[model samples]
Target: TSTGKESVNATLPVGLAMVRAIRAYFEETGYLIGFKPAGGISTAKASLDWLVLMKEELGRPWLEPELFRFGASSLLTDIERQLEHHLTGHYSANHRHAMA
Candidate 1:
């Protein structure tokens, strides 16, 4: 389902449906499925939103690194930049964080 656009709009519904089907069909709750959204998810806010979505939809267990991961270097860079801003009240230059 990699659309190369990295849109929550494109992916969220599909994820939700899969979870719904799993819950509906499985009698046991021990099965775990990892969710990783990649590509153009390049913003701190979007990453946070994805976290919230996973938390709300899939619960805290999915928040673990092994279960949930982001696959975008730009997203990592933006997250670092946001963290720096939050800590120092100053944003690093865009060039400071290089995207892979």
Candidate 2:
């Protein structure tokens, strides 16, 4: 059992533990299993935070974006804006696409 705050803080550790346990179970039975965390990640920082968490806890990097996904719409817009600026050499003034 965990307090609300502890549950939040322990999410990554608990998730990694679950992944390892599942992997071990599959390995013992001569099967293969893959795990990926999904949802709620938005900003670049949030995405990077997941990577950091995975690396710190799992001791490996998930280099491919296909292996992990961020579900936030705002993140996609931010990425597009940044890419547009990079290609055009100017930041977009379109507030309609800006993140709230």
Candidate 3:
């Protein structure tokens, strides 16, 4: 690849735009349209950022799976790590929790 980066990484900014669009659509329609940012979202920090962005843009309801979903296993893995860390004051290994 000329750019030396995967195409998915290039689309990160689009995620923000997509979330904004989701917010706009919800504002216009009064019915929530779910957001699923597929591909290249394979880390916990990125997942958390997406979640925070969603919660900020669309509020708490969007945090629900019925409204939001990540297309990567590692995304949920990181979120679980964060939750475990929150509850226990220490982060756990990625392999510790079974993926849902």
Question: Which model scores highest in TM-score?
Answer: 1
Q: Global lDDT for candidate 2?
A: 0.55
* Tens digits of per-residue lDDT for model 3, 1-100: 0131456541457767887888888889897888777767766777778788888878999899998877666567777888898899999986787874
Say which prediction, candidate 2 or candidate 3, comes out ahead on TM-score: 3
Q: On a 0 to 1 TM-score scale, where does candidate 1 land against the true structure?
A: 0.74
Candidate 1 deviant stretches above 4 angstroms = 1-10, 21-29, 98-100
Ranking by TM-score: 1, 3, 2
**Pairs clashing within candidate 3:** none
Please give the lDDT score for candidate 1. Answer: 0.72
Per-residue C-alpha lDDT of model 2 across residues 1-100, encoded as one tens digit per residue: 1222332432456656765675577568955444454444445666566667655644453334543444455566666666788899876754857564
Q: Identify the runs in model 3 with alpha carbons over 4 angstroms from their true place.
A: 1-6, 9-11, 76-100
Which stretches in model 2 have alpha-carbon errors above 4 Å?
1-32, 82-100
* 54 Cα displacement, candidate 2 (Å): 1.9
C-alpha lDDT (0 to 100) for residue 74 of candidate 1:
75
lDDT of 2 at 38: 42
